[model samples]
Target chain A: MERPELPLPQLHAFVVLAEELHFGRAATRLGIAQPPLSQQIRRLEGKVGYDLFSREPGRIGLTPAGRELLPAARHALTHLALGLTAAREVGSGRAGRLRIGFAASLALTVLPSLLRTFRERFPAVDLDIQEMTTTPQLAALRERTIDIGLLREPPAHDAELGFETVLMEPFVAVLPASHLLAGQRAVRVEQLADCPFVLLPRAVGPPLYDQITGLCIAAGFTPQVTQHAVEWQTICALVGTGLGVSLAPESIRRIRLKGVAFRRIEPSTVRTRVAVAWRKNDPSPLVPGILAALNQGPPGRP
Target chain B: MERPELPLPQLHAFVVLAEELHFGRAATRLGIAQPPLSQQIRRLEGKVGYDLFSREPGRIGLTPAGRELLPAARHALTHLALGLTAAREVGSGRAGRLRIGFAASLALTVLPSLLRTFRERFPAVDLDIQEMTTTPQLAALRERTIDIGLLREPPAHDAELGFETVLMEPFVAVLPASHLLAGQRAVRVEQLADCPFVLLPRAVGPPLYDQITGLCIAAGFTPQVTQHAVEWQTICALVGTGLGVSLAPESIRRIRLKGVAFRRIEPSTVRTRVAVAWRKNDPSPLVPGILAALNQGPPGRP
Candidate 1:
């Protein structure tokens, strides 16, 4: 609603004049003529219903009201300045929070180094990190609960989302150290088709799970899933127990299980893709710099 | 120094428009026409070097910068309002501090009741009461260290200070309980001319000290001084010891020394004057209200 506003211009002038205590000097400092400066003071006094300054011959001084208004006026201006500075920082990408959701597996991949470089470049931007598999991450991005998503197998064409691949890794077979396939340096996707699979539930990462099952079918078999686990490390540990064989991205090799061996699959064209996903036409300025860091990564990485 | 100012009016318009997200409604709410409101937004966007609002067919929304500026704009306006309200309170007599310097002896007289009344009437006004005798009170008032003074024997005329009589008491003689004058109901000033006087040093309160000495001059004798003390209670104690006789304001009778007796002086025209003193042209709104309270003490007393 419209209401009476503080005479900000007049208060600004008053604070300056109160400091100078001389109308001529105050006018010069304010970049205005003396008459206008005096008029502004009179207007303020009229608005306040009191004489803010005592003008007597060559002597001039603040009235009690003027003294009271001075500090309060200064406080007002200071608060306004603080507000503007904060807004400017936010408007430019120098401040505010950015929440990111990523595939839990990416933490074993590019997530750490990418986040480190993002933080160093934009120390003022708050990063809220969440580990979500592809399915939940896509949902979080669409709902805007999360601003950026780092997940595998981002949808190729979606009306609401855009994606760019930041990492790609070949699928590898995981076998118990006592298994006969553990002696081979590489295995074929067709060879794994006969093994019971320790796979992630289809609901956890639908696209990646389907891609794996689709490859098995393409190799002339429907793979049997003996067990399901959410994390690659959990699947590898299950493999170490000789429960079943599992297929995982190359990055899962870093897990270092004592009783499991990782083997590259022959013809490694079927790759697990980690893409940076964001809502199409997202307004955050913080996203571009972060996306650049994710894409560039530390050089010599696939 | 002159610097770039946030176009406050434009930001104000922007915040309102951002809230409404409709130009016509926002303009009506701001009591401005739609085109001018749109112009203000455009001008603000120009100043901020970014579009504050995105205009699309059948849709309007705050751009990132607009969202950034909205809360900051509100904060700035709120602070300005706070400043104005504070100044308004001070401009009237509703708030601020009043430093009062008073004679320590006044605590036994009108000080407590007078201050209680003042506090009730101006509860928001801070009372900074400092104990000071007349001479120092006068000096403090001139230095503007204290806003008001309650002291005795204020000078008849001072160019820098103004005084109003608040309380008057006839001088009383303090004597040793065994002294011959202790049995008398009343004694004349001339009767004490030969007695050694126990009195406050002249430097402690020049006017009252001189008033006492001047009374002896008017009695046709120059009294010999025996003891000089700073406090009236100390003076009374020395008198109780039969060191010498003393004359003091009647309120000193409240001290109640068992060895001392207080008796009236004849021709009671010789009264100790306790006055309210302040700077002649004080600009504090608190002064006039406080002065009224000091002058109008509880009922009738000499």
Candidate 2:
């Protein structure tokens, strides 16, 4: 057999009446007259084919049938309200989760601080961070699995991701302190045109490697690159052995090595930019906070 | 007048039967027998004093009232389900916003890359970032307005914000190429201890300034500081005037300034760390993404 149907207005009246136990109060809460509230509840009971409440003169209470439905009715109304609120919040940019896919390298230098500051400012938000390559980050973002990305340089497939320049730094030459040019007053890139260099792997992408190569060419000659290492520290270690010279960011000086010497190149050529990237239509509440922290760093102590 | 009540079992039966449309299917869906479903509907009709359905011996259809209540019932159920899901997700650290506060200085070098990587990995998460001073960042984190922070060293009120090291670099001296130290192999801090020094302002905090002072003291004298600037590049410009030497990170080499020389200090003593900070008990979803990014940096990029 099919279930009985009840009108929403009548059911709503029944719920309010059930709570207030009085037509006058329920009507007031519903912004309706007392007579109409009573009529609606009666109509609701009639539609359900059940006696939802017992009335004796001025007193009224729920019948067994009415008692059984109170919880479910309340539950339905609450959920409806919440859903509406959430929809509004999402549209206003005040809520919703931001799925992010990122390269692993950002975790060490800037990601921590950026994340910390972001979290400290927006506590009522959700975040999903995943480790991914630039290719996957872009792919996932396009698929709506992620909303933003942290990447180096511009992607070969730039149409999919919106890139914003955030950080940029020039490359420094790492050599042994005892090298003949180490004592020179600001060495020129041409001075090391013939020196063997340790470089990032070819797999890192030709664009970046080509950038370094191009810089060397602009400095007057091609570099004699000997080894390829993925991490900057490894390249510095090779340079410490006096085997060759390598180019890295000035930040590398922070990672001390016993025999490594860092020098600025004249007519600086290789500048690397790390960027914040996101899909054009991505909407995540955390995006604003993360961006703000990135621009401002963390708060002060005390 | 008193409003009538609604029967619990009848509402439950109504919802299930409405979805299934057949007594046997509805009963099966509700994990109950068809007889009970029938009995509950009859009881509901008795309580409401109306016909909720038009029943023909072997078939049934909802009355007008039934149509109106369907949406409300569905809404309530959805909310109940979502409430439970949200609670579980928040407890598991898989959802919820992370508020963050930060200072302006970090925006340049490290913040952008971190935020970009985080957004890419956690597109469904929310982040809130606030730009503030170091003191306010710490206070906000403590007051629960923020979940994390990013700032420089000597953080005040260790009792409030927990600090973690993210990036560290040593100070290098910036001078004019025409200066006497430009020709030196490696100048000690004491060599220009009495020379006018361009220093960062006290607003940046005493810890940092003291570090510079401490380095000079360790080198056997105090620096004769003259001008004070707010930012690193500004101090570098002052150094370019041949007025004095300034200490800064090797990263400062990125800024192009005519007639400036960068030199390494012997027995280097000044080092600065950029850190990620947060309250001890923050339970925001954005925290994990940020933490993951900070620990790994961007993924796949060499």
Candidate 3:
């Protein structure tokens, strides 16, 4: 299809007029004179071969064609705004590319689905998915090198970014099949009060560590956290050897380990929430797609 | 921050050169002479106040600044392309609106998630989500009025649009809690072979309806379908009355009916797969966000 030639400034004027619905009000909004705004809208209408507004003296409203053009106009404006932002960021070499830093533990669970969905949806978008530790991911997001970070719990520096929970799963206790708890239909939180627990590393984030501690506290006693591992697999392996009982999300059921039995914990106290965190003022069209994919369950898991 | 003067032709040339790597190949790619391409790149470097390329006669490589500028260049080009497309589309009154024609049966499982995600991500994009039969969703997509469609398995016209599976869930049998089948750990497919079936209407699409028939055939008997309903709720209502057995996705667990009991079918034979269908050439950037959200499991379910 041949490209149409329309003055960009005239289109901008039309957008302001559409939003305000009055010539004088639109002129004021654009910080310009009313006569110039009216002239620009008329020129835009002439160039587009259609009347955008119905201006009958005292009454003014968007015509059918005007209403139809609103979304495209808004999209064009947004695209331009994003382009301007990218140019500035790129010129300074600060934040043009979106380096999506995620933890290795999420690769099998939520990360694959999120990446696949994001890639398929935004093929032109430059996404650098780096496997990093929670500390690096948080650090990168803070330094503005990474545009977004997907973490298991809310990041320690929540004040710098907007965080929204994308996935939440109740914790299931993994234990050796020969253990006494295996015979029970459901394991109570209080039953593990005195048992040795395999816990995530304190470096994962204090909030998550605190959450586990709170769960144990609610269970009537502090858990004897015997092992501190950085990844869930280590925790599961520890549980497999009858070393300790560990809590993990239900989605972790995809990982099969011999001698391990996963039982739903009664009065589910340990709920893990995965969230997407990005700088509050960072403007990127890719954020919406990333969030959408996360909301859609992880890809391969049933 | 002050807005920088970005030379459009130079940026365009630089992007083409970056993609092609070789000056001659870049010239060929942009349909111009090599001298012009080099000149444009030099001009672009001057405009941005930086040296973009490291040239050593036979070898061509990007400088750190050039590497940094690549994503922004691509982004700006994409936005420009979209802007031109939008301008053409709006000039013809076919640009901003997205006519989404969906199947009536899909309203229960897939349509809600698709609409919710699309609306949340692209609020400015006008959506005409019309609830129609499978035939109409296909017809609308072919006619170019609808940008996308949501329908059950085996889309009516596969050649017209690309179909991607958005959600898939096993069909469970709904019965009364006091029923003999409910007492068993899992209801076998053979147990429901002789039971009366409540089937979806034929208009929902033949392939999906046949999937149910095929499952029955696999179980060694043809189901005696005693009722036909257009929606899952209606079929579940019939099952609640002990009139017939009905099949529904795991999402149906959310729907509350006083007398209906959901039991997972062992050796599960039937699985419902919902897909999003769109025209192969549609260029809307917002489509990915909508697709991502739909691909994510429904909110709060996973």
Candidate 4:
């Protein structure tokens, strides 16, 4: 037989009454008056075709039927409350997953602080973090393969993208420990104008390459080229072996290479800009929470 | 941080729109005008502090936020529906547990049929069944240790109890297999006047005891007691051992005792009434379902 459909409001009223066991108290708990509570109970009984409570001179108690119905009523109320909580959490982006791609260099910059604060505040969000170079990260962002991206300032041609610059750090020079000027705290670009340069390959994309080459041209002479490496760490390792010198973001100082030494440029004017990029049209709920965490990280270095 | 309480109605609207991906179709499904649905979505976006849908020249799609909120919205709605079902089942006496007490002899009479039907009709009810004597069963019913009881007719003193007769079977004479009367198809109370009788102890309760003694007195002779057994099975076994003959309800003929034979009593006017009883004031929901099953069992013999 098909089960009867109970009115939610009445069942909710009955549940509170069953717990309080007194009309006045139950009504107070329900934020209503005793007479209305009594009417509701009566209506419930009328609908159920039986009495749920037995009334006596000064006592009130559930009939056997009421006792049987109590647990089910409680269960229904509990589930409804839980459902409400879950809906709110998901709607506000406090629960669910976020797929974010970051330039490998970010692991040493704002990524750590950003991730820690985000996790502490929104632990229910499953962060799917991948480390990729800026090029691939930009591609993933536009293709919608990743929800968010942290990359070097993206190229201007992509008008369909939006980005926020979150970090800026000055570039430093990496040299073999035994180089003639390796012990100097600051190196003038003109002093090494004829030295062979170990640079990131042009095929690795142009942002960092342009920054390094622009500084050299401003110093009045371009460095002679020697070899190319795909990564900053590889560039540092090659420089340590006396292959050539290269420029890197200052955050790479944390790598602590045994044979390599870092020096600030005498007139340090070149800095790397790290920006968060996403498809301008993508409207994910989690983006706000993630952006909030990123914005709240420590202020960018001077 | 405080969590936002998203309005359920708005989330529901967003979920349906997300699924349909078309404003007009979703509005039709929700039985409202498309403008109102759009307004609801706007209100929801305002509350969430983010747009849920990304609309373009004639097409719409979930923004990342909308996609994330969809599953949770669906979950909340589903749980709410389930909660309603559970509440209705309990209020209508279809879910929950029923603690039932029955006389041991009921296992051979109406008990099986009553249980089968009750289970079939209300499968969600957890049946906690126990066997107890009429005296204790009455006490249990009064104390609310059990919700319902099956027993021989209770005394008239129990005005606070309600009962329905579910089984009525005439008494029969139980004889030793070799007794002279055993070969006869019928036995008269007068024929057993000079023979020893085995009977249930009066200390157990008055229902069966009064019926047995009342029948003997009406027949013009009191039974000469030879033994007292607490249970019908023990009395039947004693008769099988030829210790003494006894009278039993007709249903006992199904026991198939090896050394005892049953004979119908002449002018068989004495019958045992088996009833299902509960406290008159019991407001439990389970009692009605149980009573319905009990009443629907095969009708009692005249």
Candidate of highest TM-score: 1
**For residues A233-286, could you state the per-residue lDDT of candidate 1 as single tens digits?**
899899999998977777777788899999988777989888889876666677
RMSD of 3: 32.1
In model 3, the Cα lDDT at residue A167 comes to 69
Off by over 4 Å in 1: A1-4, A17-39, A51-71, A116-120, A295-302, B1-4, B7-45, B50-75, B295-302
**How does model 4 score by TM-score?**
0.77
User: In candidate 1, what are the lDDT values of residues B81-120, reduced to their tens digit?
Assistant: 6656666787788887889998877777777888888888
Candidates 3 and 4 compared by TM-score, better number: 4
Candidate 3: stretches off by over 4 Å: A1-97, A155-157, A296-302, B1-302
Model 2: CA > 4 A from native: A1-10, A86-91, A101-113, A128-133, A176-181, A237-244, A251-258, A285-302, B1-302
Q: Is candidate 2 or candidate 4 better by TM-score?
A: 4
Q: What are the per-model DockQ values?
A: 0.34, 0.04, 0.03, 0.26
**Superposed Cα deviation of residue B173, candidate 4 (Å):** 2.3
Backbone clashes counted, model 3: 5
Q: What's the lDDT for residue A55 in model 4?
A: 88
Q: Give lDDT tens digits, candidate 2, residues A49-127.
A: 5566767558677654566466655665554344334534543345556666655545556566766766666654566
Tell me how far the alpha carbon of residue A282 in candidate 4 is from the true structure, in angstroms, after superposition: 7.9
Q: Candidate 3 at B75: error in angstroms?
A: 19
Q: What is the Å distance of residue A37 in model 2 from its true position?
A: 1.2
| Global Cα lDDT for candidate 3 | 0.70
TM-score of each: 0.87, 0.45, 0.36, 0.77
